[model samples]
Target chain A: MVVTIIGIGLIGGSLALSLKETGLAHHIIGVDRSPDNQRQAVALGLIDEPAQDLTEAVQRADLVVVAVPMDAMLTVLPLVLDAATDRQTVIDVGSTKALLLQAVEHHPQRSRFVAVHPMAGTEYSGPSAALPGLFRDKTLVICDAPRSAPDAVARVEAVFGRLAMRLVYMDATAHDLHTAYISHISHITSFALALTVLEKEKEDEQIFALASGGFESTVRLAKSSPDMWVPIFRQNRENVLDVLDEHIHQLQHLRELLHQENYPAVYQQIQQANLIKKILK
Target chain B: MVVTIIGIGLIGGSLALSLKETGLAHHIIGVDRSPDNQRQAVALGLIDEPAQDLTEAVQRADLVVVAVPMDAMLTVLPLVLDAATDRQTVIDVGSTKALLLQAVEHHPQRSRFVAVHPMAGTEYSGPSAALPGLFRDKTLVICDAPRSAPDAVARVEAVFGRLAMRLVYMDATAHDLHTAYISHISHITSFALALTVLEKEKEDEQIFALASGGFESTVRLAKSSPDMWVPIFRQNRENVLDVLDEHIHQLQHLRELLHQENYPAVYQQIQQANLIKKILK
Candidate 1:
C-alpha cells in the first residue's frame, strides 16, 4: 500500500512507523504544513518521502491518514477527502469524531473516508516522540462506520488489525460522549490539578519537594500540549461541558463531605470510587 | 538492634523488609492489633517473630516503629510514648503530622518519639504487598524532629538513611500544609475523577471501553485504601479544604473557557500548567 500521512507529528509519525513495520504500507509519504516536521519525519525514517504536493500525494496514495490536531481537522479533513477517489481510502485518527464526521457528511466523497481513533498515545508529541507498536492491544474505535464505503471500512480494519489493535464500532455521537468521559475529562482534570498546585507553589516553598510518583502519575497529563487539547475541548464543547459540570459537582461534594467532619461518608465515597478498579483492570 | 514495628501493613511491612535487608534491624519484632497481619508479617519473613505484649515489646526493643493508621495513631502514639524509655527511640509513620504531634506534645516521654513519614507507597496494602526497596531513593520527611531528643532524631535518620531514603526536615504544620498541596489533593482529585466516570458509566454503556493508560494513571489513586486515607483527610481538613477550593475554582475557570470558546486562553492556561514539569522533574 502507498500511504500519505498528513501532520507528520506524534500520531501521524507513529502510524507511519507501524504501517511500515507491519508491511501494510510499502511506501509512506509525509505531509505537514511545517517543512521542519516533514524533514524530521523523513530523516527519522518515519516515511519514505516528504510530499510537497498535497493533491499529488493524495491522488497517488492508496490510503490517506489525517492525523492533525482536532481544530485543524475541521478544514483539513474535508480537503483531504475532496482529493479522494472511490478507490482511494481516507481516515482520520483525531480524538473527537462527531464534528469532523459532520463536516464532510454531505461531501460526494464521504464514503471514501473512515473515522478511526486508536485509543493510544503518551503525553509526548512530535515526530521524534513517535514509537512503534503504540496501538498494539489498544482499542481502535471506528466511528460512523456505516457512513463509509464497505471497502474503505474494510481497509481501515485490515490496517488496524495488522497493527494488532482491537476494533470497537460506535456511532459518532456516542463516540464523542464516551471519549468526553474517558480521554477528554482526564486531560481537563489534570490541567486543573496542575494549575491548583502551581498556584500553591507560588506561596509555598517546599510544596513540590514532597511530590511523589503517585502525585506525578496523576498530574502527568498536565504536560500534554494545549495545542492538541484546547481544540478538542472546543470541538466537543457540549459533551465536555456536561461532563465538566458533573466533575465539578463531584469535587464540591467530596469537599463538603470532608468539611462536615463526615469522615465515614468520605470513606464510603472513596470506597465507591474504588469501583473503577474493576473496569480499569 | 532490636526493632519492633507496630501495625504491619504496607508501609510497616516494607520498612521491616528494608530494615532486615540493610542489616539495620538485627532482630525485627512484628506488632499488630490484628493477629492475621502479625501472622502474615512473620510468614512473609518481614519480621523474625510476633510480639504479643505491647509493653514487653516496647521495653525490650531498642527502636519502636509505629505504622498504624492515622486515626489509631492518636491513642497508640501516646501509649507507645508512655512505654518509652530514654534508651528506646519511637517513631510514628502516619501520613498526617499536625494532630499526631499535638496529641503527645505535653506528654512526659515526648522526646523519645520522632515523627517520620516515608514519602512512598503503592495503592496496595497488607504484608504481602511489601517490597524491600520501597523506600530506596524516596523522601523521608521528619516532622517535629526538634521536639524529639537529639539522639532519637539521629537514630531515625540513621535507620532511614541505611534504607537509602533521602531525608527532609519539616515542622508538623508545614508538613501537613505541603502535603495537602502535593500529595493529599492528588488523591482527592483522583477519587473525584473516578466517581465522576463511574457515575457516567451507569448511564452510558461502553463508556469505560475507551479508557487507556492515561485515564488509568489519573484515577489510580482511587484504589487507595479508604481505611488509610479517610483518617488523613479528617486530620488534615483545613489545608485540604484550602487546596480543594482552589482546585474547584480552576476547574470552573477552565469550564467557562471552553464554554466561551476562548481557545487562546484555554491554551495559555494549559501552557501554564505545563510549567509543573520543572518542579516535577
Candidate 2:
C-alpha cells in the first residue's frame, strides 16, 4: 500500500525503512516541515519520494503516519484526520497520546486516526538514524484502538505485524500515565544525570575520563533530542510532575538514609529496586 | 606472578579471567568470605583454587586483588597489607577510595597497597556474570598513585594494562567526589526510577508493558547488586549526599519550569544536559 510518513526523523525514518523492508510500503511519500529533513530522508533512501505538501501527500496515500514532535502532534493529528478519506488510515507514533487523542476527539474523520507508540528509539535523530528492522521484536503500544474503525486498526496491525513488532493495547489516558512513569520520566532522569555530571566535569576535567558503561547507559538518554522531549514533558506535564515528585522524594529518602549512615535501609531500598529485574530481563 | 582475588564476584571474577587470559597470573587463587562463592569461583574456573582464608591467600601471593564490597574494603585492605611481603603488591577494586585508602594509610605495609577503580561494570554480578574481556578498552582510575610504592603502582599498572585498559590518575578524595556525581548518582537515579515505575505499576499494572529502550537503559542499573552499591554509598556518603542534592535540585528546576509552563527553559536545560555527548561519546 502507498504510505506517507510526516517528519522524516528518527521514528518516521525508521518506520519508513521497516515498512519498505517488509514490502508493506509499496510506494512511500515523505511530508516534513523541514526542507532539510525532506532532502535527508530521500537522500538516505528512507522514503521513495518527498511530497512538497501534506494535503497532496495524504490524498495520494492509503496510509498516513504522523511522526512529528508531541507539541506539533496536538495540531498535526487533527489536520491529517480532517484531510483523510474514509478509505485512508492515519496514525501517530508520538510519545504522548491522551492530548493528541483529545485534540482530534471532535474531528469528523477521528475514526480514521489511530494512536500508536512504537516503544522504541535511540538517542540519535534524523534520516541518517533510520534503519531496517528498527521495530523488530519490540513492543508497539496502540492506544485507544477501539476508537478507530475495525479496518483501520486491522490494516495498521498488519503493517506492524509484518515488521515483527509485538502489539499491546491501552487507552489514551492510561497510555499517557504509564509512559510518564516508564518512558518520559526516564528521559528527565537521564537529562538531570547528564547535567549532574556535566556540571561536575566543568570543575574537574578528568571526570569524564572516569565514565564507563554504567554511567554511559544511565546517561544515554541525555543525548536524546530536546526538540522531541520538551513537547512530551509539556503534553504529559501532570503525570511527569507526579513521577518527578516521587523520584525526587525517593532520592531524598536515600539522601536521608545516607546522612544518617543507615546502611541497612539503603541496602533494603536497592534490593526492592532489584525486583525490576523480573520485569525487564 | 602469583595472584589472589579476595572476592570472586563481577569485578573480581572478571579480573581473574582477564589475568588468566593475558598470562599475567602464573597462579590465580580465590578467597571469599562466602564458601558458596568460593565453590562457584572454582567451578567456573575463575581461579586456580579457593584459598582457605584471605590471610593465607595474601601470604602465598605475589599480588593481592581486594575485590570486596566498599564496607568490607576498610577491613580487608589492612588485613591484606598486614599479610603482604614488601615485594607483594595489594590493590583493592572498591568503588569508594578515600575511606579505603585512609583505613590502611597508617598500616606498616601501606606502601604495598595500590588504590585503583576500574571504572567499569555491568548490572549483573557473581562468578557466572564474569567475562574474559570485561575490562578491555575501559578506563581504570589509579587514585593516589603517588602514595603507593612505585613498585606497587607499577605492578598494578602492568596488570590493568595487560587487561587492555587505559589508566587515569586522580586523588582518592577527587575519585570519590567525581564518582559520586558520575557513577554513584547514576545508580541512585536508576533505583529511584525503578521504584517510581514499580510504585506506579502497582497502581497501574500496564506500566511496564509500555517501557521502551530508553526506560530499560535508564533503569538498567537498578539490577546492580545491593551488596555492591550500599557500601559504596555508605563509604562515599558525603560525596553522594552532595551530588544527590545537586541532582535533586536539577530535577526540581525542570519540575518548576514545567510547573510554570516555561517550555523554553525546560528546552534549554535539556540542551545543556546534551553537552554530555562530548564527554561520553
Candidate 3:
C-alpha cells in the first residue's frame, strides 16, 4: 500500500516509521508545510519522499494519514476527503475529534474518512523527536466510527493493530469529553506547575537547584509545543474548561485541608488518589 | 566505619545499599519499629544486622542515620542525639527541615546533628522499593549547617559525595520555603489531578482507557506514600499553602484565556512555562 502522511512531525513521522517497519505501506510519502521538517523526515528515512502537492498525494495513495495540529486539521481533513477516491481511506490522528469530524461531515467522500486519536506522545516535537514503538500497547480512539465505511474503519484498525495499539471506539462528543479529563488537563496542570516554580525561581536562584525526579515528572509536559496544545484547548474549549475548573477546585480543597492542619483528611484524599495505580498499571 | 540506619524504609534502605556499595560503612546496622521491615532489610542485605535497641545502635556506630517519617523524626532525632558521643555524628533525612532542626536546637549534642534532605525519591516506599544510586546526581540540601560541628558537616558531606550527590547548604527556613515550591507543590498537584480524574471516572468508566504517558507522568507522585507526605505538609503548611495559591492562580488564568478565546495569550503563557526546559535540563 502507498500511504501519504501530512505534517510529518512527532506523531506523523513516528507513524510513518511504524507503517514502513510493519511492511503495511510499501511507499510512504510525507506532506509538510515546513521545508525543515520535510527535509528532516526524508533524511531520517521516516518517509520515502516529500510530496509537492496535497491533492496529488491524496490521489496517488491508497491511505492518507492527516496528522496536523488541531487548527490546520479543520481545513486539511476536508481537503483530504475532497480528493479521496472510493477505494482510498483517510484517517486523522488529532487530539480533539469533535470539530474535525464535524468539518467533513457533509463531504461527498465522508464515508471514506476515519477519525482516530492514538493516545500517545512526548514533551518534544519535530521529525528528529520521532521514535519507534511510540504507539505500542497504547490506546487508539476511533471517533464517530459508525459514520465511516466499514472497510475504511477496518483498514484503520488493521494499520493501528500492526503498530501494536489497542482500539477503542467512541462518538466524537464522548471522545472530546474523555480526552479532556485524561489527556488535555494533564498538560494544563503541568504548564501551570512549571509557571509556579519558574515564578518562585525568579526570586531565589537556588529554587530549581533542588528539583528532583518528582518535580521533573510532574512538570515534564510543560515543555510540549504550544502550537499543538493551544489549538486543542481552543477546539475543545468547553470540555477543557470544565476539567480545568474541577482540577482547581480539587487543589483548593487540598489547600483548605492543609490549612486546618487536618492530616487525617489529607491522608484519606491521597489514599483515594492511590486508586489510580490499578488503572494505570 | 559503622553506620546505624533507623526506619529501614525507602530512604534508609537505599542509603544502606549505597554505603555498602561505596565501602563507606564496614558494618551497617538497621533499626526499625516494624519487625517486618527489620526482616526484609536484613534479608535484602541492606544491613549486616538489625539492632535490638535504638540507643545501642547509636552508641555502637560512628555515624547514625535517622530516616523515619517526619512525625517520627521529631522524637527519634532527639533520642539519637541523646545517645551520641562527642566523637559520633548524626544526620536525619527528613523532607521538612525547619521544625526538625528546631526540635533539637537546644540539645547538648546539637553540634553532633546534621540536618539533610536528599532531593530524590520515587513514588514507591518500603524495603522492597529500596534502590541503589537513588541519590546519585541528585541534590542534597544540608540545612542549618553552621549549627552542626565542622567535623560533623564534613562527615555528612563525604558520605553523600561517595553516593555521587551534589550538596547545597541553606538555612532551615529557606530550605522549607524552596522545597514547598519545587517538591511539596508537585505532590499536591498530582494528588489533586488523580482525584479530579478519578472523580470524573466515577461517571464514565472508560476515562482511563485513553490515559497515556502524559497523564501518568503528571499523576505519578499521587502514588507517593501519605505516611511520608502528610507530616512534611503539616510542618510546612504555610509555605505549601502559598505555592498552592500561586499554582491555582496560574490555572485559573489559563482557563480564563481559553474562555475568552484568547489563543495568543495562551500561547504566550505556554512559551513562558517552556523556560523550565533550560532549568530542568
- Angstrom error of the Cα, residue A14, model 1: value is 1.8
After superposition, the stretches of candidate 3 with alpha carbons farther than 4 Å from their true spots are none
**What are the lDDT scores of the predictions, listed in order?**
0.91, 0.88, 0.93
**Over 4 Å off, model 2:** none
lDDT (C-alpha) at residue A34 in model 1: 93
Tell me the tens digit of each residue's lDDT in model 2 across B1-281: 89989989999999998888888887999999899999999999999988877678888899889998888888777878878888789888878888788788789988888889888889999888998898999989998988889988988888888888999998988889888887999999999988878877776776777777888999999999998888888888888888999999999998899999999999999999998888878
The lowest-lDDT stretch of 10 consecutive residues in candidate 2 chain B is B202-211
| Collision pairs in model 2 | none
Model 2 interface root-mean-square deviation: 0.8
Write the number of the candidate with greater DockQ, choosing between 2 and 3. 3
Worst 10 residues of 2 chain A by lDDT: A200-209
Stretch of 10 with least lDDT, candidate 1 chain A:
A200-209
Task: Give lDDT tens digits, candidate 3, residues A60-125.
Answer: 999999999999999988888888899899999999988887788799999999899999999999
Q: What is the C-alpha RMSD of each candidate to the true structure, in Å?
A: 1.5, 1.3, 1.0
Query: In angstroms, what RMSD does candidate 2 have relative to the true structure?
Result: 1.3
Query: Model 2's A-chain: what TM-score?
Result: 0.98
Among all candidates shown, the one with the greatest TM-score: 3
Best-to-worst TM-score order: 3, 2, 1
